[model samples]
Target: MAADDVSVDDKVKRTRDLLSSFYSQDASQISPPSNTTSRFATLDTINTTSFDADQYMNLLVHKSNLEGLLQRHVEMAAEIKNLDTDLQIMKNNIVGMEVNMEQLLDKIMSVQSKSDGVNTLLFEKREHIEKLHRTRNLLRKVQDCKKASEEVMLVIVNKLEDKVSSDSESIQARAEAVMLLKQLDFPVEKLESKLLEKLEQFLEELDLSKDTSSDSANPHESINEGIESDSIPPRPEVPTREFVEAVHAYHVIFPDSEQHLVKLMHDLTTRHFEAAKQQIQEQVSSAKLSNRLRFIWTDVLSIDEVLPEAGLQDFAYEAARDVLKQYVTSLFSYLLHEISDALLQIQKDGIGEEYPLRAALEASKNALIQGSTKVLSDIRYLLDEDLGLVLKLRDMIISWVQEGFQTFFTQLNGQLLLLSGKDVPTDKVSSGLVLVISQLSVFIERDAISRITEEIGSSLLGGSYEYGSSAFYISMRTQRISVLLRKRLTTPNWIKHKEPREVHMFVDLFLQELGAVGSEVKQILPQGLTRRHSRTESNGSTSSSRSNQLRDNRSNTNRARSQLLETHLAKLFKQKMEIFTKIEHTQESVVMTIVKRCLKSLQEFVRLHTFNRSGFQQIQLDMQYLRITLKDNAEDEAAVEFLLDEVIVAAAERCVDPSPLEPAILDRLVQAKLAKTMDQEPVAS
Candidate 1:
């Protein structure tokens, strides 16, 4: 019974708490937990056995103690039920309306599509109407021009006016049309003056009209007289938008304005070009030649966009080619001066030093290579990258620079001759400089020219090629040797009366100079890579073949020979006679020319002096060794042999008693000369 009473009281207390929380407006008040005793006190005071509806209501009303709160709750519950019923009705209506709205939206979309089509048709008609109007206006202007006593082609002006509305060429066409419209009413002289004024401003902007001479004269201003100068506006890559407008204005207002503008621009280009030339006339390598050229052409080609209807781009190309030609010629001149200065310094004090010529020649060669490369690169940048013109300028500019030698090569040789005056006699050591010059010429032609031309590209060189310097130098090689021979084949050389003991000092000097030429050639030319071959034989059969080959000899004496000749008339010589062989530039061909010259000079030198029997045999010994030395180092071995025989014959003719040296003695003397040369190698090292 006690548990039942407690349970009943708990049910009553829960009912009371539910009523309070549901009716409460201040949620914070309900949020705070009431004391435990206060919560159960309502149950403690409630009647236990009365659980009927009326009893529950009376109990709830007594516990709540507020009729308004119970009434508000009952009213709110009734309103919520009514609202739910109405909401169901509203949902059904909304579902129906959504279906109707979808149908209405499709109808709206159809109407919008038709409206868009109508708008497009209207726009097309309007555009057609505008076109017909423009055509009518153009025809009317043409008719009016035809009817006028002093008729002008107003059709062009009207067409330009019509074209101004187009988007692609709108800016330039608008400039022309607007100016042309003004010209029909405005003073022609005033418009011309305005155009001229703008033209002057454009020139000023480009700094083409600046008194570069005055600027150069001022030491302070000269320092700042480059494209980077703050005195001038930044050079526009194209004509300024305003300048183009002014140009078109002038061109439309005055038909002759194109010729006027072209003439003016040509003048400006000339002056600009001249100013740049002045900057580099004193020092080409020092001046900012590439940048200055960029500045000038950038403006010329830019203005050419609208200034002249035609020919200006080609003019720019030709003018630029001319300028580059001058600069390149100047570079050659500068190199010539440097080489001459070095040679002059050497001639003063380099009596015994053989290296000065080689050093000077190689330095000049390398400088020319680097300078020519830079020149071609600058040309490439201007034509290929900046101007977007490659082939025409490449064909023109590259040919100009590359073929400069055609006209200048003679000047070069002439200058070289003048440097070494014919009356002057140099030392034997420096006498070989002519051969070195010949070697340099061959390198430039055979290797440097082709390599540089190919690297820069042959798309411009056409199919044909010419190496004028190489041909010219080779043609004059013998003549140049005559000049050098003044030192070597003197009276003293021909007047020697010594026995045929060994080779003369001239042989060693000649060989040493040829070796130096070879070494210098190796340095300047391209040497991509080299790989040393294995010294070891591939097999024992190769070694056995070599040993088997060594046993065959012509001379039956214990003094063995290299090979037995098939014909007794055939002269048996050493297998190896090549000296100073490197690239194609430095091999037998180079040495052959000098050898021929020396031999020919010797023949003449013999004619100048009479020889006794010993002196004649001495010449024979020298000639025999030189024949063996130079026979294999020639392009035409038979010619060299013929020349060597000519020398021997000349010596025999000059000898008072021309009897042949003994074979054993001649052989022994040649062997001793070879052995002494071998022995000197280690000591020199």
Candidate 2:
């Protein structure tokens, strides 16, 4: 057993030595190991040489082991073969995928090319559609223009046909037709020449008709029989309708022709006015003048009728304006002469019981009013009620009236200067001034101003015309009249002396006028306002007395009620007196204004001129009288007192022979001149 263990150990040692040598072999020469090769060559050697028979017997005993190893190797080989087949299948799939990708790329390129073609087609089609739209729009416009042109031509032809066919058509219709043709851009030169020829023919026909009508009326008389008569027969009326139509047709064809007819009408009206004036001047009768003026105005109206209605009003206004200007111009000299004659009569006759100055002024005023009324009434008759034209004519007539009055006053003033001082009655002159101013005030207020206000107010409210400028013009005329009155009436030449008596006369007149105005106004003042006082009674013992006392109590109650009624009546009276009070106030203001102005002038005159002591005394006395007189008239007491002081001071300043006024006299003057409330103490040195 010991010997067998030693041999086994030796074989194990040899197997370890062999494994180490095999592992230590050079890597360069190394190869896969053979399946049959032994890792331990010593073991192989021992098995082959010493234990070969034993190992062979052991292998025969372990044949199942060798078969198990072979089965594992076979399973591993089968797994490797399956992996190789899967790899081949994977490679084939990759090739197929590459081919599919190429096919998809080819299809995308084709689609892209087709899309390019479509885009180009779309671009070309878009341009074509735009061109078609433009052509369609242009064709529509051309068709519209052609239709409009055809319609215009048709209208022109129709108008021309109507003008040729209708002989009885209105001048306005013919004119409108020609105007329409011109508006349609038709040539009108031939039409104008044709109208002129027709006008000439119509005039010739009118002349023939007139001659025939005259012959038929006066056939027995020779042609020279009426030629010797001083009065010429009335001219036949012109064939206005036919002539107007022809003229209007010409006007439509040649727009400048209207001016020619207007010029003709102007000349004709001028000739008629001149003829009327010459006849009236020769005859110099109011009836003849009025007749001639009426005739001329009627002629003017007829001319207006001949004109086209569209422009009739304007033409008539112009004609009437011109005629009025001519008529007023021609009549101005005659009117002035008549006014001068009337004033001369006043100067020669003196204002007697008749008050010739008042009569003369009334005559002049009447003439002016009549003349204006006549002219305006004619204008109203002739022209349409165009407020603008009416206002314009009214203004012109007002200006003419103002001029006439101005001329009359200017001449009258010159003539009044020719009167000797003795011949000129101071009372008459003062009365004339008051009368004239009052009459003028009433006339202007009633006739001119009220009428103007009514006309302008009506026009403004009715919206017929803008009266702003017209109102301003009328206001200027009113101011002109005021200025004229002040200039002519207030001259110092009319007085002839700067005497205190003469100066005080105006003051007396002013006071008297104010007194009259106040008296007239006071009549309408509230009355019956007497104050009552409480009464103390003595006692009487009687039953009848007691009954009498009861009756007295009832009477007292009735008186109380009557007093209440009087209060209400007084209120009504105040309301009714408002306008009269205003007029009275106005008169007072006018008188006061004149007084102040005259007082100022007198003061200046008194300062410049020397006055004797006697003159001063007279003036002082007169001022004292005036002061007392003004007290009852509600005159401004302070103003009156101030004026008195100024007059006294001026007289003192201009006193020639006085050393100084006596203190007593100065005190007296101051006491009279100062207001009643002023101290009556003597003035200190």
Candidate 3:
């Protein structure tokens, strides 16, 4: 036991020493200890000791427990081996999972790179599209402005075309076009200037073309012939129709130019009128004057026809009127100056006693007749001989001549008053005035007034009535002359206070002359020789007594009465033949004219003046006696009586007093004078 114990102690010590050495050596090379022999020797020296039964039995039982322990050890070894195999399989699977994870990571990186590239390309495309949209909007604005401008230009073109084609085109359309252009921001002023320049250029080209065409058609023609070949020959030279139309086009486009053109036309007319005035001043004969006037009229007509649409016709007509007025004024001035010179000469020559009043009066009458004849002949040549003038123009000329003669007579009367110096007797002056009036009446009534009446009648009736053969025309002429004389010659002004006595004496002379004609007419009519019948008595007596008285008276009267009848019958037949001779030579119209003139003159003269009571009474008595004498000769007794009554009433209204005499008083005086004249008529008869 003691040996075994020592061996165990030795084995423990060896194992400890070996573990110590193994731990102290290099760590890479690990082994059990290098002193293994010592340990085995220690195990071999363990002593052999004697065994006991009790111990043996215990040992066997413990051996059974060792077998059971061995079996558990064997199962633990098998579990360790299986766990090793599972660990190897897990390591292999881990290697395969790592390879798959690497492949998936590579795929995800590639996808991310592709997505970034796509985003870059999309951003560039978006910018490009936005720029295109902005450019398109700009182009659209420019297109809209261009379209508006084109529309305005079209409207202006249409207006210009219309103005060129027609004269009556309204200018309002062009004006509206100009307003539209301004609203569109167009340059209108510059456009208008360019358009005007174009118009002028076109006009010039048109004129040049016309001239070239005319020359080509007549190359061999002379300059004068070329001028004459024009459609409107250039006497009163004015613009052609085409040229006027072009100018009018300009006027429509620019209205401010019209007044300038009108002034140019007016100046041309004035120049022509001045030339006509000079020609008239130089002319001496009536024939030359008439020719010049006709030429002026022709020129006016030519000018009017040349540019009829240019508003120049009225200006031409006015120019002609002024020319005519100048000619008429010149003629009248010449006649008046001559008459004044003659009157002055007569006054100077009659200053001495050698030229007696009667001789001076005779000389004055001759001078007046000579001057009047010259004037009348000149007037007659102008009015009656000149045939080309229209009727309306001729009538105007006649009126001008009448007014001129009136002015001439007025100046003559003034000159006569200056020459007489109030020394001439009223009776001599009255006689001279009567001679003058008679000559004027003869010329006016027989030549001027009668011809004018015939012309008017011919025009109105279209020349259907002959002057001498038609009784109606003769009667109309007589009535016309009577009216003309009353209205023009013996008007109220003729019997006014300035020359009252002259016209009154003329009335007296006319009545006396007509009364002598009536006396002659009465002698030819059988009514003048007839007498009123006498009444017979019807009382009766005894038959023997009545027979004795009747027989004694009858036998004595028959013897004497028979001788008287035979002698008177032969004388009556002689008087009848003489009456027939006078009747054959007389004109009833001449008698009627004289009676009417006398009655009108008396009526106008009495109506124009107021007189004293004595004068009025004397005039009334004369009127009453004249009324009785004129009743047998007057054409209308009622007309004559009414005119005389009007004259009496008018004279009473004009009585020269604070208060005029009543009309009733004038009636009473007229009646009293009439009764007195009527009482004297029977004694005179």
Candidate 4:
């Protein structure tokens, strides 16, 4: 019972406490406001309400209702708390979204500002482009104006050129006319003055008139005098009958005489026909005739019926008289040409020595002189043409004098050599023969001077065939025995021309010995023997047969090799000669520039000697070793250090240093290695 009572009391206290809990009170607030609804309350007020049974029976029923309501309110409070958490999260998200919106607005404003700036720039640029277009149009107009001006200037220049050309030609023509007038002694100004004076006098006479009646008696007397003069003209200077007869004679002889007779007649007459005929006939009969010419032309022809040498003099003389100086010059030229042809024939005919056409040559020379004299005299009469004729005649005569004697002397020397059994005369030689050589020297010297003058104007001491070893050889060969004449002449102090003074007997002996030695050398080694070789040989029987074949093959190969080498070497030598001559003629600066280029190119070719595999490999290895010694701390420097050093050293050594070139030594060692290539190549053969 005590436990039950105690339990009851405890239960009552619990029930009362539970009822109080169901109608819980709020803290921090006395009561809800009169306007506030009881249905809702704050969370702190709801947490105080908790245990409820039935609100202690009857009151428990109302309490139960209150408790159920309180329970629903508690669940509602939990849902509200969850809704508050969701609302807090949503508020934070909305704040973040507002910040993002502010950022986006700032970005949009910035982009708009940039667009506005770009538009402003574009507008400014467009204005500048328009300005440039305007400038271009103005420049185009100015350029057009300039081009038009240039065109006008060019046309003016062309017109000026044409005018200048025409003026130049007119000036030239006037100068030529003046020269011709001077030659003819025309006195053009004096003649013009005299003609003007005569016209003025005639005009004055016409201007002066008189009365016919007062001067009638004078006029009648004048008329009577004029009629008397006309009737008997004082027996003119030359009679009409004489003039008519002379013209008739001239007409008859006109077919036979060319300009010679016409010129003579014209000179004598000057309008008096009879005087010209008388003078012409006297001059023709007085001309001299050659006797030697008569002997050869008449004698040679009469001897041989098949071989004819006639009408040469008459033809030569007639040609001279008809063509005057031109004919004579042509005759001399033809004589020289004939001599050259005869010499060529002598060589071709193998006439050997011991014989020469001396008589025939002498006859031809006599005929040439007679013809030459006639033409020269006739040319003298044509004073205007004479200077040209004299020059041509001198050139032709000089040529004939040089060539004719040269041929004669050369042939004579050969004959003498053969007759004397190649024993050239070592004693006092003939002066006449030496004189011929001296004449040749003079001719060559004069020709050289004239040729050089034509090419480079007058200069002192013009180019010459240097009288040296070559000159001595030519003199000796041309005048084999006559070479000894220089010694006899040299001893005499009176001798002025010492050009061919020395008589070297040793020259003849040397030539004879050289000729013999050359023949022996030619017979022994021949040519291209170095090209033929073999290491192996067969047995006796085979060797005999094979040796003959081998010899025949070698002979043919040697001959071909000799020919090819000769031909190629000749061509190469000729090219080298021409190049050397050209190089000598070129300016110093041009040669230096060319040599520089050649050396640079040669250096490039020489650099090819360093091979890529072994040579370049060893070079790279040595370079690496050199770099290691240079700087131990180097990283990338090791790669390029040696390259720099080597390049600098090589350039300094090759370009800065001077060295002697041993050609013989280089050729044997250096060129020997290149022999295989040099053999097939087209260099210097």
**Candidate whose TM-score is highest:** 1
What candidate 1 gets wrong by more than 4 Å, as runs, is: 1-191, 194-206, 209-242, 252-258, 279-301, 308-310, 347-386, 406-408, 423-685
Taking the tens digit of each residue's C-alpha lDDT, what string does model 4 give over 571-621? 343212111111111123122223222223322332333232222222222
When summed lDDT is taken over every stretch of 10 residues in candidate 1, the lowest stretch is: 532-541
RMSD of each: 30.3, 30.5, 29.6, 46.6
CA lDDT of 402 in candidate 3?
Answer: 57
TM-score of candidate 4 versus the correct structure, residues matched by position: 0.15
lDDT of 3 at 177: 49
lDDT of each: 0.56, 0.48, 0.46, 0.34
RMSD of 3: 29.6
Residues 1-685, model 2: lDDT tens digits = 9967964675565445444444555433433235533423322443232346566445544543666447534743764576467667767988998999999999999999999999897987889999999999999999999999999788867867578446676555666667777787777656665555555444444431112023222221322465543134334444444555555456546766666666645654555455554554453333333334444455456556655433544555675566455555545555445544554454454446456657766765665555444433333332222334345577675455445444544654454354312367676554454455456446755785445344433332221123343334333433443443344234433223243322334444445444454454355433223221111110111111211221122233354344334434443433221111111123343334344444445556566556565565555555555655554442333444445545655654455432233335534654554443244334421
lDDT, candidate 3, 400-503, per-residue tens: 65566667667656655644445666654444444434444455446644454444334333332233233343345445444543553334332232311112
- Stretches of candidate 4 exceeding 4 Å from the true structure: 1-119, 157-392, 395-685
Ranking by lDDT: 1, 2, 3, 4
Assess the local accuracy of residue 626 in candidate 3 as a C-alpha lDDT between 0 and 100.
57
What TM-score against the true fold does each predicted structure earn?
0.32, 0.25, 0.28, 0.15
Mark the regions of model 2 whose C-alpha exceeds 4 Å error after superposition.
1-166, 179-186, 196-322, 325-575, 578-685
Prediction 2 global C-alpha lDDT: 0.48
User: Candidate 2: which pairs clash?
Assistant: none
- By TM-score, highest first, what's the ranking? 1, 3, 2, 4
